[model samples]
Target: MNTRILIILALIIAGIAGWFFQQQGKISPPVNIEASEVDYEATDIKAVQTNEQGETEYELNAESLTHNPVTNQDEMSGITMNWEPSDEQRYRIEAGSAAINQQTGELHLSGGFTLVSEDKVSENKTAATDIEPIQVTGQTLKGNTKSRQVYSNEPVKVVQGMNRFEASSMKANLETGEYEFGKVAVTFTPVERQNKALF
Candidate 1:
């Protein structure tokens, strides 16, 4: 698979914030947001969006969500989101916590999150190495639906097959698969050690 195609995973995962906020419609800006209690809460919430072509584009799930008035955003925990930009590769995310503006589809996440890019598992293990999965991890991330941008100023890491990358910051264009990383460090795992390190 093309490296460019594999990198599309970043764009899809970053778009989750946009999806989260879009699911919530017509939210009013509240005064005394800090005084607001949990207006709405749910244990399992799944929000799915489809394109004009009627293909599922993104599915966002959260283990729990709380309406916080002070921040005026939905407080979400145990978030697991998936995006299918195309039929070939899927992007998945497991995030610790996120804050989303219900009105604007702005998203910010903290604690930690892992984004994975992988093809559907096949019965044949022989081809697993052919299109190696890519992983990106960060302590913080921010997404804007209007701008279609996802970025992190904190250190970010990316791993693919036997290689690992660390960067001071990462910015990816959601509309394009273009990625920009700051101060990067790349390490290639030796063949003898890769089998033990990779999942």
Candidate 2:
């Protein structure tokens, strides 16, 4: 009887030890992830232009512009854009530190940039038509002396007439007076439309 009891106790202990080992095998160790770093640089840039209008044209300056040949990416530092004032809404012009694609001749402006419009209209004694802040990244841009078009894989905001629109992408044909946006979101303020009859 003593021998049989000892044998049973040994079997029970062995079973408990096996169960603990199985549970330990089921557990997985934590994984470690490492962070990555990116490196880049920029330098002094300047641009000047003369407009036919009598209004004084402004100059643009920047600290630096850079392009990564390995990634085909470009960047600009401390960019500035300026324009000449004119009574006639003649043309759309942009000047800034930009990265030009060697293959396609596409230009990309980066860092601090400003866009100014010559067209200004007064409505209800308020200066209503004004250029809004814009940030553009694109594959190419094509336009003429009178109009401009910017094509990109990102969104663009445009205000025309009394409506403002945002879209994922766009093709603006300024010559034909046509602009189309893909997956567009538009908003119109009621206050602007109220004065439409007066004009």
Best by lDDT: 1
C-alpha lDDT (0 to 100) for residue 119 of candidate 2: 45
lDDT by residue (1-199, candidate 1, tens digit) is 8889778877787698678878786567754534347677888888886766987877889988888776689889989878665545467877999888857868788879987776655465435446677788999889864455678999999887877889999987654545789999876555564345554
How many pairs of residues collide in model 1? 3
Which residue ranges in model 2 land beyond 4 Å of their true spot?
1-44, 49-60, 66-75, 82-97, 101-104, 110-116, 120-148, 160-162, 173-178, 188-199
For candidate 2, the per-residue lDDT at 35 reads: 46
TM-score of each model, in listed order: 0.63, 0.38
Error of 1 at 144 (Å): 2.5
> What lDDT score goes with residue 138 in model 2?
38
Off by over 4 Å in 1: 1-35, 51-54, 69-72, 85-89, 120-129, 145-147, 188-199
Q: How close is candidate 1 to the true structure, as a TM-score?
A: 0.63
Write candidate 2's Cα lDDT for 1-199 as tens digits.
6999999999999999999999988746767765432255546767554445634444556677566666454555555544333333223334344554444534455332223344445343456445543333333333222233445456656555445667787664433334567898866455453434654
User: Cα RMSD for candidate 1?
Assistant: 27.8
Error of 1 at 158 (Å): 1.1
Q: State residue 6's C-alpha deviation in candidate 1, in Å.
A: 98
